[model samples]
Structure formats: structure tokens, C-alpha cells
Target: MDGTSSPGLARSLFLLLVVLLSSSVAFIEPCDLLYDQAVQAFYKGDYGGVVRSMEGALHSYAQVRRSKVGCRLRCEDQHPFDDDDAAAAAVAELRFFDVVLRRSACMNGCIEDKLGTQSMHRVSEDVVQDFHRRIPYNYLQLAYQKLKQPDKAAAAAHTYFQANPEHVEMGQNLEQYKDLQGVQEDHFVDREARPHQHSFSAGVRLYDQGDYEGAIVLFEEALEEYYKADVECRALCQGPQRFEGHNHLLYRYSLHELISVFRCTSLGFLENLVKRERCLSRKRWGCPSQTASEASGMDMFGRPFHLHGRLCREAGGFVVKAAWYLRRHKQELELLLIGSATMGVEFSEGQYWSSTGGREDSNRIPSGTDGWMEYVPISEKKNVSVMSPPQLREGGPLVYDSVRLVQNSIALNGTQRVLLDAVISEEECSDLKHLAHTVTMAGDGYRGKMSPHTPNERFEGATVLKTLQYGYEGRVPLRSARLFYDVSERARRIIESYFLLNSTLHFSYTHLVCRTAITGQQDHRNDLSHPIHADNCLLDPEANECWKEPPAYTYRDYSALLYLNGDFEGGEFIFTEMDAKTVTASVKPKCGRMVGFSSGGENPHGVKAVTGGQRCAVALWFTLNPLFRELERLQADEVIQALDSQAQSQWDHGLHINPKDEL
Candidate 1:
């Protein structure tokens, strides 16, 4: 009986021990749980998740302190220790906080690597401020360096060295930072001097408005400033001081602008000349005919002779009468004379010369007589202008105009081939605009115009509204991905149908751009007007001579634009022919409108300025490579899984959470 009872008692005790251990594990401190989650997230390459977990950990630590002090030990909280156990707990909490801070420092770096350096600014303000306060300044220094903010990086480095004067690497880092600061200051001075930012801005404004002459004047002034700055830079480089790299960007920029202006001016002149010639030819027969004469006397072949000629046009042919003289006993005597000369004209009815015999050879002229010549005007072929297609009638759910062939040939073959229409519904347009607004609110507004000093001067005032770019393996915000998929799918279908391409061709990464109007009294330099350019060329304006080889596996063969909102002024999509003077098409943005074309030299295009209100559009680029299909498929699946998980979480928590709130 004792043996049986002991076996049952042993089983009961084992079960009780297991239950107690489970409870203890479940009741672990919230901070510890959060920190563990953060570590797991970091290992999974989920930097955003890591940041969220760390934030929760910090909050949990705060709650623990509050509960320990009964919410009334503000002064004692500084020491936060009533006994050895309490002191140890307090020390452990501080160590945890330090670990959290260190992990958060890597957040921006990971984000930059996955997205781009420009995306670092999208990090939360709270996270950034906390990092600045708690982490070493080196992280901030590295971030600012990546951002190209040298001054800020230098300041951070300076603060770091001051804090750790005896640090092993402090001397080396401090020296490097000082040198960087000096270089930055030099560049700042040079930037201020050359192109005189204000003057350059004014020049760009004039150029955009078609005021070529005014633009030329301002550009020249900017050019002068560049020259002076360059001279000073050279002198500085020759001294005994440490040699910082010279910046010739402004000089190069000014030269490029001058060249572009000159080219545009010459093209404008040629276009005007062609138009004037066309007009003159229309009234050629009605114009009055005029006669002119000239005389000269000179020694030729050791003989003195006098010559006289009269020139006139008759029946679309030039006629000349001439007389020549020879000296006889110091007296000038006429030796050769010609009259009623009609040049290169067939003898037809009343148009024949009366005095001149038909087919007279040159030998028939008297010795020393002046020689008469005639010129027959060659008939020029008349150019018949190709009529433009009739404009589409307004007020319709959908309207479109197929580009008409010009001069009975394929119209703007290549990149210029475009179909314009309101393709999507107003609902989609409204939804996209709302999504863009939400994205803007979640981050520091849009990244303003970048590297305005690029060769493409038109980019100076161009502000990107909300841009989202991702590789096939990278994750994109759910809303942005949805918008991208919908617009690109529709655009791909349309392009395939129009071009009769195989449906197997798929699209690659896309770029979404939004532009707003220039406000206040600033010159329209910042207005978004993409200069005429091929989509597949070297992006740097300074590297105009660089030619990118066509991709082997994939090519940006086709480009499409979907306009989300059209209630804007001045922004028109303009396509120019190879000559740059002829506009193949000028499309106005309309809500739900889509315009697509080839993306090579065959279709150079640009945007006009956005004068009022705002403009938003999604640009989708397509490729023909088959390898990208698998990548795109995997990405789509990942997006689906992410969406499902998010939905499940929201439902489980019984909370109406915005997907972007996670971002």
C-alpha cells in the first residue's frame, strides 16, 4: 500500500513542479521580453521591427520604475536603490537601456543600406533624438557623412572627442574631422562665389519661360562669377596650406548652360528661317523683279580691259548683259558686247530672247569682248504640311487620341510614340492622392529637390512629392505597393496591347513623382519642368558625352506616366522630335490620364512648369527580361503574406491600425 501511494504522490509532485516553472517563465519582466524580441528582429534583418521593439522596451523600463517608486519617488529615483538587491536591479536596468540605445544606433544604418541614404531622414523623430542623446556621437557622424552633411558630421565628431579626450582613436578621428571641416568651409565659400546662386537661379527661370536672350545675359553673369571663383581657387591650391580638392562644378555647369543656350538659340533661328522661306515661296510670283549693274577695269593676262554687266531675272531665270573694252592708242574701245541674254531657259513661245541667236557658241564673241553668263533657277519641291489630328471632344468618362502619323510617315517613331487618355477612374485618382498625403504625414515631408547643381538645370526647382523605390527583394509599404501594382498592371496591359508585344514581358521597379507649384515671391526656378531628355541616357548633365550601353538582359524599353490629379497649371507633357524644334505631342495632365511612350532617343520628352496647384504622377518602367518575372512573383507573395499578418494582428488586438503606422 505504501509503494502504490508513493508512486501516485511522485507523479502529482512532478506535475506541480512543471506548472510552477512555466508560470515563472511567463511572468518574466516585460522589458526583458521586449529586448529579446528586438534581438530576434535584428537578426532577421527587420531593422524597423527592432526599433519598435526597443521603443517598447524603453516604455516597459519606465513603467517598472514608476511602479517601484509608487509614483512619488522622483528624487530617490536618481539613486533608485534602498538595498543591495535594489541597487543591482537598478544597474541591470541601466545596462538594458544602454543596450537598447546601441541597437537603435544601427537602425538608421540598416535602413540606409536597404533603402538609400536619402531614406534615413524618414526615421522617427523620437528615435533620432533618443539616439543623439544616449548613443556615442560616432553613429550620428557616420549618418551625417552618408547624408553629405559635412558640417553636421564635423560637429558630431567634435562633440565625441571632447567627451573622450583620452580615447585611443580620438586623436586620429579629430584630425580627420578638422580637415573635413576646412574642406567644407572652402567649398561653401566657392559655392557662394561662383554661379552666384541667385544669378544662376534667375537664369534658370528665364530659360524655362523661353526668354532665351534674358537667360543668356544672366547665364553670362553667372559664368563670370565662376571664372573669378576658379581663379581664386587656383591661387589657394598653390599655397603652402594643405591642398583640398578643387571644385570645378560651378564652372562646368556654367559652360554647359551657355552651350545649351547657344544651341537653343541657333535652333530657334533655323526654325524661324524655315518658316520665313515657306511664307516667301507662297508669294514668290507676285513679287516685283529688279535689275542691277556693276563695272570694273583691270589688267588681265598682260592686257588692260574694261568690263560692264547688268543682272536681272526673267521668267524664273537670271539674265546678264556685258561689255568689254580694249585700249587702242590709249583710248578705251569696246571689244565684246552681249544683249537680251536669257539664261538656262528653254525657248518657249514669247519667253525667247529677241536679239540673241539660239545656241551661240562662246567663240562667236569678239576678241576682248565681255563674256555674258546666264543662270537657270532650279525648281524646288514644295513641302505639304501634314495636318494634325482633331482634338478630342471634352466631357466624357474616357477620352483618347491616337498619335497621328506626320507627313504620311510613322509619327515620332520610338520614344515619342504616345497614346494619351483618361484611362483610370476618378476614384482611383482620389485614393492615390490620399495615400500620398498619408505617406507625407508619416515622415518629414518629401525629400526636396536634390543636387540642384546637377547639369540638368531644370531639376533645380523640381520637388519630388512622395517617392517610393524598391528592388524586387526589398519590401515596400503596403499602400505604396498596392498603388504601384494597380497602376503598373494597367499600364503594362495597355502597352502590350498597343505595341503587340508578347505578354511575357514584365515591368521592373517604378518611380513615383509628385510636383507642386512655386509659391510666394520666389522665382520659378524651383518649378518642375524636366528638360527634353531620353529616359535611358546618362543622368548627369555634366557627363553629356557618356553613353550607357544598352542592358544585356533587360532594357527600359517603355515608360508610362499615370496622372493622379490634373487640377494643376503649367505642367504639360511635351514630346519633341530629333530636331528639338518640332513638338510631336503636348499632353495636358488630367485625373486618371495615362501617357506612355518608348524611352529611347526616338522619343525625347519633357515636362512644362507646374505653375499653380499641385501635380502627382506614377512613372512605371517596363523590361523584357524573363529573369525578373520570378523575382516579381516572389515579391508579390511576400507582400501578400505581410498584408495577411498585419490584418491578423489588427483583428486579434481589436484595433483599427493603419498599415503605414508601422512605418
Candidate 2:
């Protein structure tokens, strides 16, 4: 089909026609041979030979008839020109034929034949744009680096900030250079050192050689040795837990880098050993020890603290809920909160609780727990619906009785002073007092150990019913009520108010205020897909026995857990949902950072086991009242009626109508 075919076909046809017409002498096949030779010569760049052969064939053809070929081949039937003339004329004609046209056709044919071996050289712009939108932040950054366009790289970084504004440094840097052109050279420092920098190089080598389990053991031994050395160094410097006389930043940076390697590896035991190193360093650096007296006090970083009172949910009169934060405010809390989730804290009594505990009797609202009992319908949408659980009698860990106990215990020296022995700034004292009374009634479980009256009365630890984890029972009188006053009263009000205004539902609350050393893992039940739900929902399905008064039915509205103190570290919340969507929101152990969210099939939350420190908190759950129940029943009835009526109408029409006539 292409122009590369031989000219011999034309010559042969011409010669044959000549033989048939005049019975020409010799009936020479020389024309065919000459044409074949011309093609061979052409391959060898013999343009002259090709022209001669083509001209001879044309002249021979012109002497004969034009019957064999198509109409274009009907040339003059006479050999009017000599071979030389014919050759010149043929060559001129070929040259006049559009070379570009022939080349275009040939190019297409070549492309088709090579398609199987070729890669598509280009992608449409739309595809690239789509990738930019959905790709992960780290991947997008690498992509921009490859593109070598500083502006685009900066823009991608900005997009990352928009999505995760909690990354303070990254966000601030991005905002400073919104119109990115050239970046400052020192903006980023590659602080990631070679892994061997750590004194535990031998352990790292063992890990690299596929001895992960063994490496962990050796790493712990090295960590112990390092701690002993650091302690001696502290003694030489002055005392334990002080950073001095050296490049403090570099020292801190190196420590952080070393810790990061263990954290990244997810080798929990090795990480624990590294934390021991941190503890020694802290003592040497003069970091104040978080004593029982200090943690129980009301002052936070020497400031009079006031949480957003409006953004909480109230239960048993005590406000109980998590604090919701916009992106900007995450930083103020991050250092306090995120640091706690990182550093493992221990109980003053030498015991430490794991991060997460098993699901417990969620159906029953613990005594002193107070949360939303009424669901305020905000908006109505054709495709969306919201409802809360029915209201029931307030029982378990009674709030009113607990509040009275707290009020009687705290003796105020002056009207200005709220509670006796309560170390707080003037501003904080004022805020605490206001929050207490504003919360008409506040109640929560006493911070103590839990025990059954009889051996049989307690569900065997194996029983699923026994799985709910509560704080330890039996506490010192002086500290217990004081701790409760802040958490159950002051903190509770803020959480309750916040939820009523912003959150949709929060029905279950479980607060653990650590007064004694807590050590050992609490049972865990991830029976539901996103197994770790917040303390809002109770595990017991027998609703009647769990609540002070039965709900008349079963339902939970919402729940929250609030960290009241951030003296120690290493307690992060873990949540997993269907579709393998796992989210771990780290709660900084700060005075007032609250974690508030929905709990149900849609959102299940849990706290990651604490590694190094004692964790304390105030938890609250919300239940729907009469209004919540009435609305839900009404909606369900409507849907059922509508479906039934539609079915009946269809049947009636089918019996009476004729299909053809109806159409």
C-alpha cells in the first residue's frame, strides 16, 4: 500500500501489453529486470539508476496500449522520445510529486508497526491535575522536587498546611512565602543523621541483620548503660535533670533523633528503654518533678486559664465533654498535649496504666456523670435525619452527692480565694469558681478503685460483661476530692457547654483521674469493627440493669474524654472505623484539651495505651431525653407508612389495568 513497492510491476504490465498488441520482437522482459535492478540501486542511493530504469519502462509502456492498468496509466501509445529524453522527463516528474505527502503516509505506517514496542510519551494535563489533588503530601512534595519548579513545590507545601494546619512550623513557613519564588537556603536543615550515630550501634546492626526480636533486647541493655553514664554526667555538672554548659539545641536534637528511630520502628520495649533515658535527662536538666501536689493544683504554665465555656455538654449538672479546636489553636495545646502522648509517664506510687482499656458497662451512667439529656433538633433535610436516645433517671456515681462532698471539703480563706491549699493564679481561681456555680449540678464517678462485694457478684474476668475498665478505687481524702472538684466540676462544665453548641451527640463518658499507681493492661474489646470507641457507649446490651432507670428503650447520644493534667506523657487516643480507616488523634495531657466526637457505627474512638506516665481525665456521656425518643419514633412510623401505601397502590393498579391500553 505504501510508495516503497517496486516499479517492476508497472514495467511487466507494459511489456506484456506490448507483446499482446504488436507481437513485438524478442518480447523482451528487460523492462521488468531493469525496474527490479533500479529498486536495488535505489537502496544503495543510486538515484541515477532508478531514473534510467523508470524512464525506459515508461517509454516502453507508451509504445503499447493502456488496457491493463487503470485510467491514470492510459499514456500516449507511441515511443516518441529517446531513452535519454524519457529518463530526464521521468526524473523531473518524480521530483515534482509532493515528497512531503509521501513522507506523511510513510510516517503513519511506521508508527502503527512500532506501536507494540513504544511507550506512550505523553499524558493529558487533566490526569496530572487529578494526581496532584489526591496524592499524599509526602508524595506530592517529592513530585514537585522532581519537577524542579520552586513555585509549584511551595504551593504543594501550602496545600499540605491547609489540610494539616496542626504542623505549626510547616504552616508558618508556608504562610510567610505565599507567593513563592525563591526559598531561603537555611529554611530546612537535614537533621536526620545516620542511624549508627546512636551509642547503640551494635543493636542497630543486629536489627539490620533480621534479628529484630533480638535487637530489641540488646537495645534495652544499651539504654540502661547510657542512663547510668548520663546520671554520672549529671552529678559532675551539678545535679540530675539539667541541661547546661553545652550546645543545648544540638544535645536536644540528638536525643530527639535517637528517640525517633525507636518510635518509628514500633518496637514498644526498645522505646520504653529510650524513655528511661529521657527521664534521667529530665532530672539532670532541672525539670521540675510532677509531684502529687503540683499536678492537683489549678495553675497551668502560671496563667489564669479559661476554656471556651460555651462549647461543652452538661450531665448530672457537671459539664463533661471534649474541647473542639480550630487549626490555629492546636499548637498552643500540641506541646502540652502531644508531648504527653510522646513521653510515657508513671504513677508517683510506681505503677503505670496501659494506654487503652477494654469496653465496660457502658449502658449504665456512672454516678456523678452528667451530660445532655435533651436533643435539640437544629435542621431538617429531606435526605438526612438526626435523633438522640430516650431520657432516663440519673443514677450511678451520683453527681449531686459528689458535688456536696467537694463543696464541704474545700475551705476558702477569703471570698476571693476559692479552695484552701489550691495553688492557682488569680485569673484561674476566678474562672474555676464561675464555672462551678454556672454548672447548676455537676457529678462524676469518685476517683478510686472498683471492687465487687462478693466473688460471685463480680463477673469472672473472662466474662465479656466484666470488661468495662474503671479507675482504681481507694484514694487519700485530701487529694481525691480536690482532683474531682477541678475535673468533675470545672472541666466538665466546659466540655458540656461546648458540645451542646457545636457537637451533634455525646452520650457516654469515662474519666480516669489517677490518684494511685495504675499498672497492668485493661481488657480490650474491639467486638465492633472500629473496636476502640470512646467511653460514650456502654458495652452491656441489657439496658435496664445498667442505668439507674431504664431508657424505656436503648440508645446513646454522644461521649467525650478530657485530659485534665499534662504533667507526664505517652497516652494517645486510637480510633478505627470500617474500610480500614484508622485515625489516631494524640491527646496532649494538658489542663483543658478536650477530645469530643460522635460514637456509633459512624465513629468509634479509643485511647492508645500509655507507655510511660500516669494519665488523668474527666469523661462524660450524653443521653437523649423524651424529645429525642418521640422524634425518632415519629420518623420511623412515617417511613413505614409511606412504604406500605406505595405497595398497596401498586397491587391495586395491577389488578385493574390493562398493560397495552394503559400505555
Best by lDDT: 1
Q: In candidate 1, what are the lDDT values of residues 360-383, reduced to their tens digit?
A: 222121111111111111111011
Measured on C-alpha atoms, candidate 1 has an lDDT of: 0.41
Per-residue alpha-carbon lDDT of model 2 for 350-417, expressed as tens digits? 11212111112222111111111111122221112235542322112222222211111013111100
RMSD of 1: 37.9
**Local accuracy by lDDT, each model:** 0.41, 0.32
Model 2 vs. true fold: TM: 0.21
Model 1 segments beyond 4 Å from truth?
A: 1-416, 440-484, 521-528, 538-546, 550-554, 579-581, 626-637, 641-663
The candidate 1 region of ten consecutive residues with least summed lDDT is 317-326
